[model samples]
Target: MNLATHAALLGWIPVVLLLFASLPPRRALVAALVGGWLFLPVAGYDVTGYHDKHMVLSAGMLAGAVAFAPGRLAAFRPRLVDLPMTIWCAWPFVSSLANGLGAYEGGAAVLFNTARWGVPWLLGRTLLADRGGVRALAVGVLTGALVYVPLCLWEIRMSPQLHAALYGFHQHAFDQTVRWGGTFRPMVFMHHGLMVALWMAVGSILAVALWTRRTLRDVGGIGMPWIAVALVGTTVLTKSTGAVVLLAVGASVLLLADGARVRALLIVLALAAPAYMAVRLTGEAPRTAVLDAAARVASPVRLASLRFRLANEEQLAAKALERPITGWGRYGRWIAYDDQGRAATPDGFWVIALGQFGLVGLAAITAATVLPVVRLAVRLRRRRAAAPGAGPAVALGVVLALFAVDSLFNAMTNPVYFVAGGALAGVDVRSLVRRRRPAAAQGRAPAPVVVAGAALASPAGSAR
Candidate 1:
């Protein structure tokens, strides 16, 4: 590790610990997590390949939650997703048997990988499970964006020296920072420039959602609309093609939504990319026809990239099927190897999940992420009128849609993917809770459930 990375870790860990002692459980939890992801050292700071920052604050927060806020423990209680994740978590250890790397190495793979898979989503979901918590999270994210704006702008001019300047090493291939547009993309503290752009995109969408819902007006000081505007600008300047498109779509949805029942639309949107992915990865997709159709809107170079990417996924999927149920396991087990045993890196997140942990891993995550989204949509189908705080749910769906698009090509393993997943699940889960309450207390007839999500940028009681 570089001197700067060591220094940054020494700094953030203590600060997070202090906040744990001084701040409220939820606030401290959120602060430690949000702060860690935003400002801490990058990926090179690893404990035997695991990012120590993620393990320390993220998984640590859940343990802290159990000790400090036991009553809110229901947040960690898995409903539909519990079983699959159990399998997902345990399979790495089992796969180690076939691809055995011995006890110390194998155990470390399972232990750290589980922590990585669990921490980010758990921290967000556990702390931000309730209405007030979700709103706080929205505001926290916006504030992070507001804080990051100047840094993002400066990095653009300076050509992304923050990671190198602060951490003493770049987190990704420097060549990858090259943009299709004639400029360098900024990485800042985020591991990659693409990650920075996606982070900005998610923040801008949340800000735009808050602005459209008129909840930001309640928070005094700098105007919420201005914050959204600033965040949107940063997302564009980040020079990530996917993120810019995602932000524009989210902003358009928030601005143009007419309070109609969009449940069917949300389901279709959520399922589209995943379905297409499943087909393509399984070698059933009409690649030529689809690429030809897409060529009308894309350049030949982009189309070739897509085709080549799909081909890579096909090779990786075949490799995974050798083990099928349990997968190839760690030690670059999932990556395709040359005759010399040199590994070719896999591209998409789904293929990554399939290769490392098998279909079970993929299924667990899908259940955790996609099922709740569809369930929420189905539950909300009958409601012709918008609920009090349905805006956040709509916003979450839009965020998920954009994430779905990103997941088609990239692995959804970063902080943003887990944070957004937990946010969506936590929001929909409230509706699931309301469905089971007594009719008198619910003040409405029992149905499947239509969680209004959280108040988002609005006050606490806005959801209730």
Candidate 2:
């Protein structure tokens, strides 16, 4: 890490405070989270322990929220849907202790996981469960993508030099920057080009959703149609085949499916990761067939990359199976080593979670991320097709499910998706239930449901 990287990381704390002071708590959280993820250095200082810039920024956001939005924090109530995340955050401690790594290490793991994963979920549940919160988040990410268009175009032509130019270091392997035929893949400040591409893809999904619902006219004064085109064009240019596929799948669903069909598709997508894990573990995965299919569509280089990842996954999964319950604990214990002292790298997040904490940890993390989407789907099913905020809610939920699917191949961790998940998990299901009841039976107008003595704002398009 360079001096500039140090300054950028340390400066983010005050920036968070400034954001909270200048913007509403919800927008502040979005700005701090989304903007920090975009521009902050990928490295951070070790004041007491090794903290990624992500966890450090998350801590700053949590502190800002507590200091400025105490009422919102105090108003948060834990639901059963939140239990999986609680477990996911704390599971590493149990695995640490099980591996005889002692309570000290175990406790540290808990803190890291909580900061990295739990804080954003809490933020979502507390500040972003409302109609206004939904709009802020969706539009915030859409706007962020628009902001990245120029940066991505810059990296595509000049070869991803911004992180190096600004932060004083390259974030990842230089070789990975160049894609097919020496085309540059923009890493921006993220860990990998694929991550940046996926971020753009997610923004595209939200743009399509907001436009389809007629909920958003403009994001930062750029019309939604133009915003959608920019995001979609950038996503394609990123040269990440997986990200393009994700954008395509998301756009197709938002454009073609009804609410019920959307919910059903989300449920299926939610189950995809766990299903792949089961098949991979049982050796029932049709690997050759899949590769053969890919070979026809994927470039030769891409096919070779997929083949290599599958080969490595086989070894890593087998090692993880050896431990079964609480797999080999951290510090590369779960990773297999060859006679030459080379470590087998686990590419997919699913296998890494399995190896690190075994099936218990895998299930916990998967449920934490996946169940919220499933819960939202079920709740939305009970709602009328025209329920306020239903369009963006469903669109955001689809992005969350796609994140789970993406985790099957890449270990890119974005807290924005968790924020979306928490927002979905925090949806006011009771309001939907009450709205379903007949107005005549209630002996009055079907008034909007009030929580804490305040009527929740209806989302856009309701003419409220």
Candidate 3:
């Protein structure tokens, strides 16, 4: 059965709307609307998929109504921190219009993708930035990983030719093949082995944060160490060298940022030892063997895989140089040349962004995206040091670290990444704006609230 077809998409419309309605008055409903819109593509209803654009519009209208509802609308206001990044990130779309490439319909693609993925994440952050929401997101991520990891293990066991058919053998061709305890390598719902590896790496970083902060205690009776072991093990099974490196780097950053000097060192050594053993077993060498070896031990198979990635990076770099200013345009590198031109790398996020958006676009996009994450990391560190037991700080730090690593090789601007990133960004923006409230309140007197029939009447006496 095409499960997508059997699910009733329209049913979710009201359900999502209700969820927005139920939120606290001070909460941002635009986030909910944006997030609800993001799920439209994946929402199929009994052989008839709901119109995605329509869903987005409806959600937006509902959210806007809620936001404009007198006192309810206070949460929807954009903050100073949000403005800079939003404008910076939007520059690419703006530039796309300025360039002749705008005619190619890059705007539609960007908008569609952004709505499908970015909106939900922004809403998730807005909704879940509170201690309760942050915990929910953390649990949701771990639960999703738990469910996804086993499915990946099953896929690996099946050794399905699906990946080869979809992404092609070149993109997923690994240097080594190992059937661990009769279990094959898992690909799960992702496109390739590398993607799976990336997911696992993300899982590991999150698990570490959750474990260290004792967030697992919230789950009742679940041991933190066991969760960490499972996450780390899954990362190893994916056999993605880049992902492994990213996990290590991300975890290290998280630990050091959190000031767990001894624990961080111990965790690093523990995670590194097995990787070293794997490398020793494989015997094949990686392109950046020294760096890879220092981070984690690699087997011959792992080494070969790492070498392939480095080679792809080199090729992508050269191609980017050819069109240093404005990339050949979105997906332009994917256009094959008749033995006359070089092609884009098969699996490289930086290369894709650079090749598609050019150096100017890349710099602008990177700054827009990375700046908040860096700030969050710094803020979390300060917050935790000053006030202990701030688990949300650790969780945010984990998210930033994971993104930092994942973005290196994967186009995290994709749907999932955007959604998550948007949510985190929303939270950051909300917190910043709320902080200025005290000083602002001292200057201007507060307005009185008037409620009517589950909705607040605006100051102008209009039902918001």
Candidate 4:
């Protein structure tokens, strides 16, 4: 079938499943249907992008289900998970208004992006705050990886020139013109390679979680090491240095947090660096001749990346000074013309926030993005120490760490980030609720006996 036909079919499948979910015999069917819907193939089928189509269809189904079936809706009520973060995210809207930058269409842009992320986030908070949501997310990641890995492999094999032609690497055409590499890195369905890499990184992390927990062996018949190896290999093939760094850092954090000896952790990190450098040096030539010599060592590649990022950072800083308070309005750079009638680079995310909305706007964006992840981290540590068997908390912590690291390099405004963020928020909010509920505290026991037993049974159990 064609792409549109496939999308329409998949989209309708959910609706039919919802109908069945409303029936007594097939209520368990909805969960599986949702899981399957998330991983359905859309490779050749470009029916308005699978994610976009799924979002639209899912929204419609959710609305209809809520209207027709209050009981089902109640099953999806917002949990206490990450409520603080949800509240914090509201600051951007307020800051936009305060800075008076929202006067033009810029306000609308802020509102639109915020709503796009915030709404699903809220929905996720309600629907996914429980074990089922956790399972759904895990299943989705594994399924997405299963589908995405082979496609990525094929694209790399094809080395299609069309990849760059379609995506347009770097921020501007001039960068592409100046660079030695192809126009864009391959992104079969995602917006860019960085995004694809980020998604793969998340998969790799999830794979770690699955392997460590022994879930992969039980469910997928795959050993943990094999899953980890596959995920790490896929990440490397993406040619995203940032993603590689993220994986390294995230893995380290996971290892330390899980109580690996500090000295052993340091030794592992120290040894891993040289090995990583060797592999990276041999991977690909630099983007420019000047960078090629530097690529002889990994430090140069890292420095070059940092330098470009810093340049963008500097440019943004200069622009922000022009309107430090309210700054430029939304799409203000587009509409607000200078004496020379030239537009400047939007630069990095920090600069984008400042230039677009000014200092006030930047602060709002910062709080919204930072607070929940921080709160989640703190809460996870406390919860894990007190209870210990909180799988969802551990997973959420990994998600937070990945986002925190990746956001420094790429914008966190993508759909994948939002979807993941929403799920994490849901988990966090639920944890908070459990902590606050007097009845829950009084009745709840320490971390589950199963987790404690597992910890004692095997040395590898410490990996989780």
**Which lDDT value does model 3 have at 208?**
77
Task: Estimate, for each residue in 1-464, the C-alpha lDDT of model 2 and write its tens digit.
Answer: 77777777778788889878876788788778778888888886675333787687788889889989999999998999999889888888888988999998888878887888888899999998875676667766766777788899999988999999988889899898897776799998888999999999998998898888777666544677888898999999999989999999989988887767877888888888778888888888667977988999998888998998888888888899898888777888899776797788788999998999899888888898889888877767534433545667777888988898899889999888888888878877445323333446657542221211212222323211
Q: Is candidate 2 or candidate 3 better by TM-score?
A: 2
Could you tell me how far off, in angstroms, the CA of residue 333 lies in candidate 2 after the best superposition? 0.6
| TM-scores for every candidate against the unseen true structure | 0.83, 0.90, 0.64, 0.64
The sequence of per-residue lDDT tens digits that candidate 4 reaches over residues 195-260 is: 667777776876665556443342233455776787789888877777887777766555555423
Q: Of the pair 1 and 2, which is ahead by lDDT? A: 2
* lDDT ranking, best first: 2, 1, 4, 3
lDDT scores in order: 0.64, 0.80, 0.48, 0.48
- Writing each residue's lDDT as its tens digit, candidate 1 over 101-136 gives 666656776677667755556655666655445555
Better of 2 and 4 by lDDT: 2
Alpha carbon lDDT of residue 3, candidate 1? 75
| Better candidate by lDDT, 2 or 3 | 2
Cα lDDT for residue 78, candidate 3? 65
Give the distance in Å from residue 383's predicted Cα in candidate 1 to where it truly belongs. 6.0
For residues 1-464, write the lDDT of model 3, one tens digit per residue: 13332332434445545544664422324333333332223222222112443334344534544444434234555654455345433544654664565644555545543444334444544554454344344444554455455656666666634434332332233433345565555543343555566666766776777666554542223455776788888787776666777787767765665444422432343234233323422444444665465446667765665566566655665565576666556546423332556553455455566566566655544443444454444454343432323444444444544554455556533333443444555554334222233324567533222111112211111112
Clashes of 3: 18
Model 3, 406: alpha-carbon shift in Å? 3.0
After superposition, the stretches of candidate 1 with alpha carbons farther than 4 Å from their true spots are 2-4, 44-53, 63-67, 74-76, 98-106, 180-182, 218-220, 258-260, 337-343, 381-388, 423-464
